[model samples]
Target: MNVEGRTIEEDAVSAPPPDLSEWALHAFCLGARSSPHPVVAMDDNGRILYYAVGGIDMDRLMELGLKPNESQLALMKAYRLLTVEDGRLTTSFPVVGPQVMGELRRDIRAISADVTQSIRRDSEEMCAELARRGHAHHGYAVVFGHAVDGLVWEQLRDQLPSTKLSLERPFWNGAFWAIHPRRDDAAGVNEHPWSEGTLVSVWSARIAFELRSFLTESAVGRLTHNADGVLPVIHSDDSDELHRHGKLIAERLAEAILCDPRSKALSERIVGTHPGESLLIFAHELIWDLMDCLVEATPLVRPRALDNGSAPASDLRQLLFIRQ
Candidate 1:
């Protein structure tokens, strides 16, 4: 909490949800601690099931103009920015709600329980798997994808040594996900919708752990699955292959940049130049390869923050390396 516009973390343990509607969101929760990165449950149609912890509280935080503090942990169940610190976690989405108050109640119970269970799962099965493979990384859950799985996440943990991931799930007011518990229903579609897009958002974070603090940040992307809304399960054996596959995706994107009929125009618009921008286009699309290679990814991006705010773009200016 801030008193006189100054940090008074002296009593953070005693801090309750801000009585105010505003909130102060933080950066991505890279694996530096043992808590669930808030999760967002969505149905087959891609609408949110409920705010596991609640995004409105976060909107309120932003209204107060507090930037994301990588060292702080007081946050809501949002994937807007995946980061955790000081035992707190924050993720985000829009203010798209009339979110059933009862659903919020259930989510509170489930989220609390799952966060702990998730942490334990990581330390137990997930961490050991990494050690066995001579790898080093432990991932947490996100507000996307199917139920957070311990073994499945080990692959990503190994690939991104300095990474933390989260899986989202929401409890409906009085409904159950027809696909699985972790995946909730979308906005308009009932939890039992037929033939809708069954997809999950995959939020990836890269962390720089400091002595008393950790710097966490990530990009959000999607992975769409079948009609039942059940995300296809990717077990361990398929993990290494997925990493190589992402590289292949990167290569394909480079070719697409050269061959796509509108590639030249799109390149010019994005970089404000034409001839020298091919690499930029390739790099931009390579971000897709980065996404594809990940165990999961969000299929879409929310337009703007609920507060009409914008995220700080990573310094991609240096990612423009051209192939010799």
Candidate 2:
């Protein structure tokens, strides 16, 4: 089947291979003792089906040819990221190929300039409030970023058209991208105590690869180690932080509208509900223009994190994804 002017066969041929070195570096930073092999599965027609890790059975594969183990498949299914339909193992989530990505990038960039401005205003206000409250720690910034995601979800979920396809809990809750590290058995591997950590970025499913590339190229955020893992922090003093932060927020908002099921439903509903209107223009209106109306009537505050006498920074750090 053709998608976004490209055939599935073309996508299979054009899709870049997963970067092993990048994954290895990420795993190493996470203090993983071992790393799982990343896997990509496709159908006979060259339609990409799954992008995952740790479903391969090397013992059975080397002996009897390559195949996924039944036990591992079952576990994936349990997570709702994979499914068995008509005796075939299939991906349960959406995957966007290069063609669609190109189209989305073109469409998004057209309105991203304005959207970035709106996001910058809001973020500045948020940052200013944090500073006034003496809560301008990087941890609070991270938490507020995620809280924005949740706020967006809550506002748009009910307005969106409903779909029968159920999303995985992690995806539904906006925590789909996660890093699982193996235990670090080797001692004295890390010279600095805070150097041992993992960096994770959260976004919708389809644009996972693209978003990673964007973050890498843009250098939007920096990683800081904590007891749990590494968190990406954007410092206010950095000259380009606001510009990059605004752009990153705009890109993530576009990803949600185009790729996330719930937000995509809203986009579809908007397009269908209003005929003879440009999707990009209307989307910009619905999101950026109406930002104030969409915001919660009552402002949200994490009292415990703010009130905690000891280790408020640590508390805020832990609060990043705790609500999810």
Candidate 3:
């Protein structure tokens, strides 16, 4: 009996025969690779279709709530319309019938709907906060995001009361609103540049704290009176603390850019301005040198460009490097 069973199993386990057309085998191979977890292809009419289960362990099938017999049943159901070709089951036929295909598509669409709603909620909240801040500061708001999210927010922006959305600087404390999507859009980031917009206008509630902490730890009494009132000015001689302060500022700046959905674009811009591997170090050095020029001057000056080989004025220049 054992010898007979072994013969039967061996008979069942054969490579897809050559007589089957190339396209049929190709379709089966494609279905095997693309389907989810257990990889059971179904037909359009919800019929069970072909499955490649040759080497799959019995335990693995059990994990998917299948027994050896059930797995065979499911596969047979999927391939119910199959006709033998040259002593082999034809594989080129689609595993999924029309009915099952429609169900799977519907399921995917339902999932997409839920995700869209969640992202819309997040975008709305960010915009609402920007509108509130703009109203309080008597300024307009700037909304940005991945290309798709930006469009969605723009559509929703007009609904915001007393809010004007502009890509250019409107000479007000512009509230920065970024729409975060469920998935990171890498291509969009590489395409856009943050410097193209009024990056100087990015107003974060955390900026005040970051500025004070940088001043207290690095500059101490190096504070000077400027149009922005008493603020940390200029770089002293190179020291560990100054480097650390620069790193801190760079990290914060990086976070602001990355969180804004145009992080890759801004990174490209920063690289254009100060080309280097370690952006944190570049930002640190840049901040240190720029501040030195500002703080060391007898009378305060708003630097339009760096004496060193750095790019001309930017919001980062206006907000962090220079005193208000």
Q: Estimate each model's TM-score.
A: 0.20, 0.38, 0.16
Residues forming the 10-long window of minimal summed lDDT in candidate 2? 182-191
Best by TM-score: 2
Per-residue lDDT tens digits for candidate 3, residues 183-298, read: 11110101111222211122222243343334442242322323443222222223423222333333333343234333233334322122222222222222223223322331
TM-score of 3: 0.16
Write down the lDDT that model 2 would get: 0.34
- Give the alpha carbon lDDT tens digit for every residue of 203-318 in model 2: 22233334444445223223332233333333323253433443445455655555555434333432212221223323433342223322222132332432333333344343
Task: Indicate the residue-level lDDT of 149 in model 2.
Answer: 34
What TM-score should be assigned to candidate 2? Answer: 0.38
Candidate 3 all-Cα RMSD: 24.8
- lDDT for each of the candidates? 0.26, 0.34, 0.26
| Models sorted by lDDT, best on top | 2, 3, 1
Prediction 1 global C-alpha lDDT = 0.26
